[model samples]
Structures are given as structure tokens and as C-alpha cells.
Target chain A: MNGFAIVWQERALFLEGLWNTVSLVVAAIAISVPLSALGAVVLVEAPRPVARLARALIDLTRCVPFLLLAYVIYYGLPQLGLRFDAWWAGLVTMTLYNAAYLAEIFRSAWLALPKEGFEAARAYGFRPATLYRRIVLPQIAYASAPLVGGQIIVMIKDSALLMIITVREISFAANSINANYFTPFAPFVVAIGMYWMLSLIVEAWVRRVASGARLRYG
Target chain B: MTWAAFETLLTGAGTTVALSLAGLAIGVPLGLALALIRWARIPVADQLVATYVSLVRATPLLTFVLFVFFVLPTMGLELDPVPAAIVTLALNTAPFNCEIWRAGLTNFPRDQLEAAEACGMTRTLAFRRIVAPQLWRVCLGPLVSEMTILLKATPAVAVIGVVEITRAASRIGAATYDPLPPFLAATVIYTLLIAVIVQAQRVIEALIARRYGYAAP
Candidate 1:
């Protein structure tokens, strides 16, 4: 197609943007996973007041649209004597927004666990620490894997939103090319393809891990 | 002056809510059709629908909106901006709702459908009487939650120059150079909207439980 020629000429730019997207995703997930785990544990195991506070915070964050949240961090915060570069702003928004969602996913999985197992673990003279260590985390770790992977895919797809913040992610590259060439077909299609492939790869990897966990746990 | 800004934001929020609800109003039935096709396992259509759902699910909504808004005009098929947006959102949601519908369809017992067929009910009739009610009961919760996500995602359409809530907020922020207050107000509207949605889910779930006597967990 005529448009493919334009896209091919822009391959270098596209590849650079792809790299940035991948790097941002990796960093966001690395940070957010632990934060979500902490949030999940707080929602599940903490005292009532602490858990309520955590939930309200999560709910408030989750309800706002991610675009507005990004604008808040990037635009709003700068006026309040805080400024962040586009990359870090994107990273923080991605981490904080999805951590709220992932925490909910993890917390729900934890809640859905059979209470009988925990009770039995307690009945067997297991201390709370050992009971959770030996029993709870393992169960939830596997159960939450597929969901966590799904959320990771969501994060990857959503990273496109960073384009608006000038993050130079793949979508940004595509948008820039469209601006230059006025050919929307090829560049956006390529961006979509890259995203689709990344999601498929993540899906395959998660399937392998989930199956392995099933075999080991079952 | 702030009241006027709030009025603008309120109008935009109405647009946002209207678009999402209209999208779902179309999406729910369209999604069921996709699920039914998949459930019946039609040969070419099964694969076609699968690919459609996968492509839609994997790509970002922004890209999809852009393609609809920009690329479709290139093909000599033009849609006005509002229709284009509704089309984009309805198509965007159909695949997700298809998955949700498929889960309910799959879990529904096969023998009941067969019994309905044996009792001289047509396929459509069977689906209407035997399948639809329970599907609603099974699906209402997840469907409502998905609606909330779609509501939040309404901002993605703003990239195409749709002046929905987030877009309106951005405009106000740009105008006043005080982005925080407008965006914060937008956040409160969204939070309240989502809270109402979640509450409605509870009330409807309770009503369905009472009506149906209980459904499969």
C-alpha cells in the first residue's frame, strides 16, 4: 500500500517509540506490582480503619479517568511547586492508576479463597505468620496470576495514553508520523499491530505460568 | 463565572454519560449475537468473530477511535463526528461484552435448551423464554461493572474532538490556567457517577435475587 511506504520510512522513529513504551511498561509494572501487593494486603489483613482508608483511596483514584489524572499530575501539580518531566509523570500515573485496579483484583482473589483453609491452618497450631506464609500467599499468588497478567496487558494497551503527555511512546510516534505525512492508515495500524503482538506475547507467557502453577499446586 | 464553567462541565458530563449508555444499549444485544454465533460454533464465523474480539480487545481505545474518526473517511465512507464516536464506542464495547455474554452462555446448562427444542419451541423462542432471564441474572453484575469502565473510557473519544467531560475539563483548565480546580471538580462528578452506578448494581442484583429466587454463584 502507498501508506506502508511512509510507515517504512518512519521505522526508526517507530522502533525508538516501541522501546520507550516497553521500558515504561516494565518500570511501571515493576513498581506497581509491589505497591499493589502492599495495597492488597492492607485491604485484606489490616485493621478496619486502615483498610477503609486504603479502599477509599483506591476507589477515588480508580473513579477518575486516567487522562485527567495524567493532566493533573503533569499540568496541575507543576503550579503547586511540583514539576515532573513527561516520562516520570507518565510512569507515576501508570503505576498509581493501575496499582489501584490490580490491588482490587488481588484483594478480590484473596477474599474468594476458602476461609476453611485458613481456619484449618490456624487449628494446626500454625501462627498467623506461618499460616499466611505457608498457606495464604501461595494460594492467592497463583489465583491472581492470570488476572494480574490481564491487568498488565491493560497497562500495555493503556500506555498509549502517554502519547498525550509527550512520552514518545509508540502511539506518540505514530501520531507524529500521521502529523507529518497526513496518512493515518499505515502508522496507526502498525502501532495497533505492535500493541496486539505485545499483548499476545504477554498472554502466552501468562498462560504458561498459570498452567505451571496449576500443575504444581494441584 | 465558576457556575458557568460548571454548567459547561455538566453538559459535557451529560454527553459522556449519554454516549456510554447509548453505546451499551447497542452493545449488549450485539454482543449477545456475537456470543451466540460463537456458542453455536459456526465454522468461518467462529474464527471471524474470535479475531474481531481479539483485535478489538488488544488495541488501545484511542487508536480505535482515531481510526474510526480519521481512516474511515479515507475509504469514502464518512460519518459525522457524533455517529462516528458512537460507532467507535459500540464496536469497542461489543467484544468485551461478547466475552461476558459468552461466559454466561457457556455456563448455562445444555440440556435445558435441548428440552425446549424437544418441546416444539423454535430456537429464538427457546432463547427468549428459557435462556434470557437467567442470563440477565447471571450477567447483570459484571455487565454493570464493565459499563463503569466504559464510562471512564469515554475520555478516549475526546481525542477525536468530542467535548466530553474530560475534554471540557481540559478546555476549562486551558482557559483559566488553573487546571487543578476544574479537573478536581470533574473527578468528583466522575466519582459520584461511578458510585451511583455501583449502587444501582446492588439494588438490581437484590431485585433479581428476589425475582429469580437466587442464581448460580
Candidate 2:
């Protein structure tokens, strides 16, 4: 039988894997976006010591590999009497890992904004919270959308690492198919194709969003 | 952690560094060749290189590792874990490095090459003397960052049974029944390795900038 035929016969398994990957990506982005936004804000606008500390923490976290970070969270946390299920552990690891990159992206966008806008908002008697909400956040969101989208694609790809911790993602499904049929190429190539398609869709969506934002905001 | 655990982790780290260096050694030349082919605008080859880069970038490094380590054996090209890891990493990194090198090439001033050719220099001589130096300067920062990324990705080889630092930590963790200490040690070691790479990048960037009589911004 051809490789595609083999993969077709295992369509259910592949679909399940794809679904798991999507779910993991969604959950991770939902958790990380707000957390990273807060982190970016602190890194950019907080007091000197606080900003320095946030920057250091983000740097340190980024230096560690995501696989190791997952392993640490999955295995190491149990020692502290804070055990989590493999799914939750994987989710937490993805959030923490991607949050650092997202925060850096957001921080750069925040830094690139002109200072005059913030001063103008302040002159209009807008407090820090209102100023950020009414002026800064919208600008950075539009400016950073493409990069944020790219990072989301990255998060989707990195979700495969969760299979190492036994999260039963697509890679895990592929491994099982490989083990059972001894057909490594079929399952993995299928998974890679799925990942590629997902990323292409994201890239297209991001492009549309960017152009739309340019027309609307500019 | 015990002294023995530290030793084990260090040994694994040594393997990680060695593998990463070997991968870079192969990948840099291959990537530069791809970039040059595209830059020369060899039509079919350029399209093929573009497709390769896009496909590789879209997939995770883990997939590459698994494919190389597993599928190749069926085609009678069996490899041990370390070499398999190195080959997979080199293949994965080549596409990224190609993009980086291409970006650097965009910064190359065309007039210098034109002038060199007008002055009777061979294409090879002109590129060797003029274009190559500036290309290295433009590419160095991104290349170093990519190397650190490749180094960080070394742990992915553990899935194929290679005992890199992360794998070493897991083994020690299982044996000692204390996962935190070994993982903590791995974190520190990884952080230090990245710090060294970043520092080297800065020093090299400064040196190149100085050689060109320009202060690094």
C-alpha cells in the first residue's frame, strides 16, 4: 500500500492528533496572552528595579529549552508536593515558555511607540490605566499583530513537545502509528503536513489582519 | 545534587556542545551555498531552495530528528543517536541560516562589486575581497543567535536516546528520586552556555565593526 493509503486508513488517529494540537494551542494562547501582556507592561513601564527584575526573569526563562522546562515542571514539581496531571503540566509549560517570547514582542512594540501620544493622553487628564487602555494598547495591538501571530504559530509547533511528557498530542499519535505499523514516514509526514497547513492558515490570517488594521487605523 | 550527578550532567553538556558545533560546522557552509544559489538567481534551483526553506521552517525540529533517526534506518542508512542528532540538527538549521545569510546579502552594496569588476577583478576575487567581509559582519549577529537556538534545541535529541544535558538530568532525576536538583543544575548550565554565546557574539560584532572603522551602535 502507498504511504497515503496507510495514513488514510488511520484518518481517525490523525484527526484526533490534529484536534489535540489545536486544543493545546488554543489553551496555551488563552493563558499566555494576558499574562504576557502584563509582563510586557511591567517590563516597559514599571519602576527601575521592578522592570529590571522582570527583564531578568524573562531572559532566564528564555534561556532554558522548552523540553527541559516541560520536564522540570512535569517531574520536578511533584517533589514540591505540587503534582499536576500531564495535560496540565504540558499546558503550564507551554504558557510559561511562549509567554516570555510574547512579552519580548509586546515590549518591543511598546517601546517603538512615539512618546508624544502618551504625553497627549496624560495632558487630557487620563490616568495611567485609562491612558494605556484608551491610547497605548490599541496601537500596540495593531502594530504587533503580525509578530504575535508568528509567535502563535511557534506555540502551535512547540506544542508537539508536550508529547514528550505523554500529553497525547499529534506527535504522540504519530509515534503510536509508527510503532504499530512500523511505517515511520507515513505518520510523521502526515503530521508535518498538518502542521504546515495550520501555519499557512495562520500566516494568511495574520496578513489579512495586518492589512485590515493598516486600513482602519492608519 | 551529588558530585556524581553533576559529573554526569557535565558530560552530557559536553556532548550537547560538541554536537551543536558539529551541526553548525556542516550547516553554515550548506546554508551559505543555498543562499548563494538563490542570490545568483538560478531559476529552478532557487525555487527548490525556497521550497526547502519553507518546508523546514514550517515543521518542528523534533519531527526532523525523528524522521532522520527512524526512517533512514529502513532505507539501510542506519545511524547511531549522536550522529543522527547532529545530521538532523544540521538539516534543520540550514534553512534558517540560509534566510539569515540571504538577509545579510541584501545589505551588500552592489556598487562595490561593480567597481571591483570594472577594475579587472574576477568575480571570485571581488566577492572574496570585498563582499565576503561585509556579508560576515551583517550576518554575524543573527548567525550567533541562531547558533544559540540550535544549542537550545540539542535537548530534542533525547527522544532518540541521545544523552544530552536534559536527558542526563532526567536520568539522574530518576536514579536519585529528586528531579528538582538535576533539572535545576541543567537550567543553570544551559543559562551559562547561552550567556557565553551571547558574550562571544558581542565581542565578535565589536571586533568586526572596529575592523571596518565603525563603532558598533
What is model 2's C-alpha RMSD?
2.0
Model 1 chain B poorest ten-residue lDDT run: B208-217
Which stretches of candidate 1 lie above 4 Å from their native place? A116-134, B117-124
Model 2 TM-score relative to the real fold: 0.94
What is the DockQ of the complex in model 2? 0.75
Per-candidate TM-scores read: 0.95, 0.94
Top-scoring candidate (DockQ): 1
| C-alpha lDDT values of all predictions | 0.89, 0.88
lDDT of 1 by residue, B1-217 (tens): 2998999999999999999988999988899999999988999999999999999999888888888887898999798877888998899999999999999988888899899989999987988899987897788888887899899988988877889999898889989999999999999999999999999888877887788777446
In model 2, state the lDDT of residue A62: 90
Pick by lDDT: which candidate is best?
A: 1
- Report the lDDT of model 1 for residue A196: 93
Query: Candidate 1 deviates by what RMSD?
Result: 1.9
